[model samples]
Target chain A: MLTVKKASRLFKDGAAGFKNITFTVQKGEIVGILGTSGCGKSTLLRVLSGLDHADSGTIHLNDGSPSGAGVIFQEPRLMPWLSVEDNVLFGFKNPSKYRKQAAHYLSLVGLSEFAGALPRDLSGGMAQRTAIARALASQPSVLLLDEPFSALDAFTKMQLQDLLLDIWQEEKTTMVMVTHDIDEALHVCDRVIVLSGQPGEIAAEFKISQPKPRSRSDLSLATYKEKIFSILEYSNTGLQKYSVR
Target chain B: MKSKLNLIGLGMILPVLLIAIWEAAARLGWIESYLLPAPTVVIESIIEMAQEGTLWAHVSITLYRVGAGFLIGTAAAVFIGAAVGYFKKAEHLLDPILQAFRSIPSLAWVPLFLLWMGIGEPSKVTLIAVGVFFPVYLNIVSGIQGVDRKLIEVGKVYHFNSLQLVRRIILPASLPSFLVGIRSGLGLGWMFVVAAELLGASEGLGYLLVLGQNTSSPELIIASIILFAALGKGTDALLKSIESRSLKWQDNLQNAQ
Candidate 1:
């Protein structure tokens, strides 16, 4: 379990974002933080992953204060210099201990045949998969995803969503994904938090009523998506403040 | 086979035409063997020198100087280039001095070098080394410094070991630049080879030029000039072959996706 309390950030240009944002992700639960393009979604993800310091907030994990947390960014971020297996094995301090596990993860990602291939050889989807594999190799208790699947095509996205569910069910780790796509949020998240525009605050909190491994055809999922969309649409606020740039 | 035959035909056209024209001109007395030796006269002179074992001696001694000087000078330049490129302090410290030295041509050092090193092989080898050194070193340093930082960040996320980062990433990215440097350096080195020989030498093609000058034998001078041209062509071919072989991996890696 991971907790975020009173997270507030103020950028230099008097751009206030994420005001008094507080949330908790229960053990094995996957929560989605949904916002328009520039509601400080990436900043919030960065704060949770310890990549950046929040202005005034506390993020704490249960028991040992978060032994390890793996983060996947918007891009695959694979080193062009390394082979796929070597790249997957990068985080391990002890190569001997992690060798077989790396191979297992390689097969899990369906890249066993390309073990010796370099990152330049992989397609965008494969490269992102390799990045995911690299993160999972750390066996993190809290895994952070910041729009990791946005670049992937629909088919590949579905495949990865399924894989994420499988991995989450098997490992039972806490996950927090920040994304702009409401459909992806409804498809994968256990709960969705809708963030409104500048001086961003949690505008809506929705606990997904649908079951896991959900289909797009599920009525409850559609109900949740429509409900979230109506809330987002009610205010022309997030739209006006969401700058694509 | 068809392409190979086409290449052979392309290769024969210039040499055959030139030889035919030369023979006809000589036969008609339009050109003199004395002032400008015909291809046949030059070939005869080469044969005569070969029979006396002089041509082999001249060529061998010249190769010795070039091989030794190039090996030492290029190696030093590469090491220095890598170091200065990798370290900001060294680059800052050495940049001005290197620039100053670069302004002075290697041939300009000839008179002073004779005074210092006594016109020995050291003086001449030093001349050739200086001529080739700057081009290679400058290119190598630029290549190393020019690698994209974004690509390096990718290496960092993957946790690539430092040596692995340099060997696998840095070097390969910089190779094309380094090869260009070497190509230019080889041509510069060839030009300096004749200059070094002309200064003072007991043997070599350049020494033969001096001998021709002393005896007023334009035939020998033309012969030596041809030999020097041949050596330049041969060395360049060798360097290019090595370049192609070393860079062969790039094609596969770039096209693999």
Candidate 2:
């Protein structure tokens, strides 16, 4: 579980990244932070993963271990020099000890056949899957994904979404994903938090309450989609008004 | 494998044909023998040197100097380059001096090195070291600086400490450029040997070149020149093999494309 209280970050050029952002994620929950471009979603994820600092406020991990966080970037970001298996084992102090766990994670991501393959030799989908496997192999209590599937094609994105759902169900690991896609947020996440405006702040939060393996075309998701769309539209208009004034 | 062999064979045709033409032109007296010695005469000089055991002696000495200087220079460059690259303070302190030195030609260092170290092996080795140092140092620094910041973030996210990050991410990411530096440094290392031996004692292929000039034997000069070419090619081939092997991952991706 993670708790962030009134977190804020400001750029050196005096622009705010995010302001007074407060949220708590429970254990094994899949939460999606939805935002448009420049809404500081990725910045928030970076702060949560401890890759960057917050200028103000605090993030406390109730899990007690700081190493419990594993992050997957928008890009796969695999080490080009390493084999798929080695990449999965990259975070381990002694890789050989966790060799079986790495293999298992690779299989979980459906990339066991590519254990010896280099990152460059993989397709985009395969590379992202390998990245997911790498994150899982570290056995993090919280997996933070920053727009992980946005670069992927729609078909591949759908497959990855399903795979993520499966992994969350099976592994029971908490996940906080930053995404721009409304349907993607509806499709995969147990809860969705929308961020909006300049110097972004959390605008709305919605709990899906839909059962696992929910359909993209399901009538239940359409209303949630419409609500998220209106929130985005209102935020855009608000920004336009502020800029014009 | 077969295609690779065919490509090599195709590459050899021009060189082989040129050698034949030179041999024929020499035999036909198209050029005077003293001015441009016959290919056969060059071969004979090589055989004569080999018989006298001086050929191996010179080769061994030159190889030893190149090997020693190259190893020392490359090791120092990697260390200093990594230091400067990883620390802002190191870069601030050392980069300006290095950049200034980088503009000075390798041969220009020879006179100063000789004056300081004396006209001995130390001077020769130091000249070669200076020649080998800059390329490796500059390339390593640039290579480390150019590594993707995203990859460094991944390292940080994974809880890698500074040393672990450098060892796992920084070094391997910069390896391709570092190898390039090694290849170029070795080339300069060979070139500096001539400058080193030009003023010095009585060993190495460069020494043989001076001996050829003193004795007025065109055959000796040609033979020494040929040996330089052969040795340069041989050592380059060794580094090339290492480069290709270490960069096999990149090659696999290219092949897939």
Candidate 3:
């Protein structure tokens, strides 16, 4: 479980980045932070990953600490000098001790054949998969994904989405993902939190309630999609009060 | 493998053609052989010196000066460059003064070093080290500064301390640039050794150059020049191989082709 209370990390006289945002995520739930470009989605994720500090307010994981969040950025960001397996073990202080775990996660992400290969040798999808394996190998309390599959082709993106759900089913890992893709958010997340406007704040939160193995072509999802599209379009008009859930 | 051999064969064409032309001109007496020896005459002079055993003595001492200076210069550069690169405060304090020193034309340090350390091996080695320092230092600073911030963020998410970040991330990330610096530094070391020995030493390939001038042996002069070229190219090739091996992970234009 994770909680962010009144978190704000704005810049340039509050014209950029997120402000006064608040949210919580339950254990084993996949929550997607949906927003357009420049909505400070990344800024919020940085705060959650502990890479940057919130200018005000607080973020606490289950034990009242901010340490156990693993992040998968939009780019693979793999260490070019390291092999795929070594990149997975990068979070560990003693990598040799976690060799087995690295292999397991590599296999989990379908990258077992790439263990000895450098990041350069991998295709974009494979490289991103390696990054996912890397984050999983660390065994973080919560995994924070900042548009992890946004750069991939549609088929690779869909495959990874399904792979992500499979991992969720097996590991029950809590996740907080920031993404601009509406369908992607709908596909993988248990809950979707829409953020909008300059100095972004939460605009709406929707609980999918749809069971696992939900169909993308399902007419029910189309209704939710249309509703989300209206809220996103409306948010673009001007800064407005956050609508009631 | 065949392509690699073909590339080498392509590279040899110009040098071989030039050498052949030089031999023809000298043998035909189109140029005064005493003033500009034929390539064969240079080779013969080299062989004569080798038979006399003085060739190895000069070559060994020159090799020693370059090797010592390279190690000393590279070590100092790595230490100081890493410091200046990693810490903003150190960069602010140190970089301006270092850049100023770098611009002074390292040859200007010769007289001062000679005055302080005298005509001993120390002066020669120190001069070579000074020559070797700047490129390595500059490359290292840029290399560390250029490490992708995103990768450093990855380290930060893992809660890596400053030392761990530098050791595991910064060092390896900057290694390609560091090696580039080292290759160039070795080149400058050879250059300065010639200057150092030309001004002070009793032996070394540069001394061979001086000996030819004083005794009017154009063959010896050409021979020493040829040896300098051979040794310089040999060392550079060695470093290039190392660079390619270590940077095999790079997904750059070179690897793509």
Give the least accurate 10-residue stretch of model 3 chain A, judged by summed lDDT.
A236-245
C-alpha root-mean-square deviation, each candidate: 4.9, 1.6, 2.9
**CAPRI quality of model 2:** medium
Q: What is the C-alpha lDDT of each candidate?
A: 0.80, 0.90, 0.92
lDDT of 3 by residue, A17-102 (tens): 99899889999899999998888999999999888899999998884334498899999999999999999998888999988999
Question: What is the DockQ of the complex in model 2?
Answer: 0.77
TM-score, cand. 3: 0.95
Which pairs of residues clash in candidate 2, taking residues 3 or more apart in a chain or in different chains?
none
Give the least accurate 10-residue stretch of model 1 chain B, judged by summed lDDT: B248-257
State which candidate has the highest DockQ.
Answer: 2
TM-score of each: 0.75, 0.97, 0.95
Top candidate, metric TM-score: 2
lDDT of 2 by residue, A1-245 (tens): 88999999867453558889999999989999998898888889999989889999999887744467989988999999999999999888888798899889999999999999999889999999999999988778899999999999999999999999989888988999999999998998999999997778999999999987898889989999999999999999988898899
lDDT of 1 at A130: 89
TM-score of 1: 0.75
Q: What's the CA RMSD of model 3 in angstroms?
A: 2.9
Total clashes for model 1: 0
**DockQ of the candidate models in sequence:** 0.23, 0.77, 0.77
Local accuracy of candidate 2 as per-residue lDDT tens digits, B15-105: 9999999999989999888788888899998998899998999999999889889988998999999999999999999999999988987
The better-scoring model by TM-score among 2 and 3 is 2
Classify candidate 1 by CAPRI docking class: acceptable
